[model samples]
Target: MIPSDDRQPPQKGLFELYLEDMINLRHPLVRMAERIDWPQCEQQFGPYWCPDNGRPGHPIRLHVGLQMFKHMQGLSDRELLDQWVENPYWQYFCGESTFQHEPPMDESTMGRFRRRIGEEGARALLRMTVELGEGTGTVAPGSFRVAVADTTVMHKAIAHPSEARLMARAHRRLVARAKAEGVTFRQTYERSLDGLLMRIGRYAHARQFRRMHKRLRKLHGYLGRVCGDVIRQKPYGQRSQALDDSLYQALYLLRQYADPKHRPKLYSLHEPEVACIAKGKARTPYEFGSKVSVITTAKEGFVLDCQALRGNPYDGHTLHEGLMRVHRHCGHLPVHTLVDRGYRGSEITPLSNVRITGKQKGKGTAHPEHQHRRNSVEPIIGHLKHEGLLDRCHLRGHDGDRIHAVLCAVGFNLRKILRRLARLFGLRFIQELLGLLRESGTQTGQSMNQVVSIPV
Candidate 1:
């Protein structure tokens, strides 16, 4: 259901005026809110909802505004809501007729709203930003024809995945869940596991590899004992899905312990889908998370498309899908898809009429001006990571990863548009000030002439 709009001026209460009256209308956020096409937003996210089911949710503008606010400032749900209550501009931007003294919704409700919209809805939000950029003249229409592309790792919010830590977490999680499922065990090892894990860490830090492996083996044996106990009690066919999954994880851990080198390793017991990607960096040779590919306009570096590539695919493998997304967003394929040497040996070198740059030397000579633009994407990716939410993802699962990456892109565009608006606002203000000074000067000159004529 669509949220009702109450932004009409006539409905204002006698005691409380509208937020538009209280806050500066010239502020960028207020100007931006006016620019956004709320009807189009209702059209985009309207299909997800049934017109007659449940009470109408909050206004689509509020949800989209909150999404922009979240990424623009790199804030979590709690932080955004806490400030939303106090910031009249934020309230006004979200279509609040009057100031909000209390939070509009709980933190958990925002999470549910995000999930309800899902990945496609998130992409719609990104599309809206692109439209806003084009409408405001912040991003040029010609720049969309040529885009620079790059990939970066969006690290998950998890600790370092050491053997001892993985084993201990698996052990504790399995035992606690089993007890909840009414399974009794001998020597649960909940208390003793922490001390053993601490010791393993200390030994490893002291360069005692042999002792660390020894304790690792001991922890592995204890986990094996728990697995044996559970197996003896509950048959595989009769176990709950979660119990079965835990049992398999335990078995996988045992297999890794038996053979120190294993394939398709599980980095975190809580987040099993995470992968170890080695991007050939000295400081961060290996990052354990998903790979995100971002495509931006060559002219102004506005994010045209962003995708989270799972399975840690080769950088070359992700180009086709990313460009296709770009086409979907911009309504046409980029003529030049510029990338680094990482995408040198890609199979789809010639993406239709689009000339893939960065592999050939003569290509740079052909387009000298845009050759340097490829490297500009690095700062865009850096900004998305450091300034937005892509540095460390807190959302769960691959869906969360996709949505988060797209929202960060939207936030980056909003930041650019805000700066452009602020620049225009400042220039206008200066022009007004100069006009006032000139008018006052003319009046003073005319008055002085009259006084001089009288004295003569």
Candidate 2:
């Protein structure tokens, strides 16, 4: 069943005061809640729930608001839930009228919510933020016409892959599954594998390449024998489908890791979709994740769009698709897009109505201001990684990658909106204060001159 907010006033009890009565209305979160079109979001998200079914789920506002807070503050689901309990402001932001001591929902429910929404829904959330920026005047109308585009890697949460580690992990997974299925293996190699892994690490650290290679072969042999045993006992029923899938992946990795000529290697066993992206950085030469294309307004720095590219495609080739996404989401193509030298060879479709600008020097050069805006995307990408959750994604699969990138942009834009609102409120407060002082001076029957200045 679709969840709806409780509209009734809080029941009279020992303490009649409610959270809505206590929180300051001028707070940024409180004010932002009012500005956001919750009814529209509820209408859009309500269909995900069955009209008549299991226990009612949490309110759409609670789930959506919690997601906004999670990315804006860079808090994990567990951490966000804990903080929501102690902060009335957070409860109010989630459309709660009364404060509750316990968590509104379980932490695992967040993952389900993300899966239910999928990539398209995440994009809608981001689009809503862009619309919010336009409505609040933080992002000027038609600013989307002049935008900047760039690409960055959103790294996944996986350890650095090595021959020893891969073999050991495969061996452990196979053994654990065999034990769980009540299938007795010829030899588990449990004790010997542990000591072998220790020696393999020591050998690699000491630059004993030959010794490390020899031990890796032994580990691979152990994994091969265990795999054979599991396969021989195969006739797995429906219940063992997950175990069968695990064995299939282990065998696939065994083949790929053993061959040096494999075109695409597996970097992570759990996150098979993770790709190794190499952006020529001096400090970090290689990044393991998906490449993301980010588009932002040239002047206001509001994020226009964020899309995760599947393979590690060239930066130049991603432009056409990025521009198309911008058009699909915003309903208009940019008039001009500023990009770096990496996008030099790419050709934009004429139908896009977007003019791509790269670095230019002497004659036929772009205007100085337009050229300068190309570098503006650098800091925005940095904030997306540091402040947003783009640095390390915690969700699962390729869809998770796309959803994570979009949510990070959503978070970034929300933070910017909040900062703008706070600045506006501060200026209004100062003006009111000055007006009050002027009124007092007039009432005192004496001319009082005063200069009140406030830093932006």
Measured by lDDT, the strongest candidate is 1
Candidate 1 wrong stretches, greater than 4 Å = 7-9, 347-359, 362-367, 439-456
TM per prediction: 0.93, 0.91
Error of 1 at 338 (Å): 1.1
- Local accuracy of candidate 2 as per-residue lDDT tens digits, 196-255: 989999998999999988988888888888888888786556328767877877787779
List runs of model 2 lying over 4 Å from the truth.
10-14, 179-184, 233-240, 351-359, 363-368, 446-456
For 27-137, candidate 1 gives per-residue lDDT tens digits of: 988888889888888777777667887888777778878988999999999999999998999988888888778998888978988898998898888888888899988
lDDT of 2 at 388: 83
Query: Top TM-score: which candidate number?
Result: 1
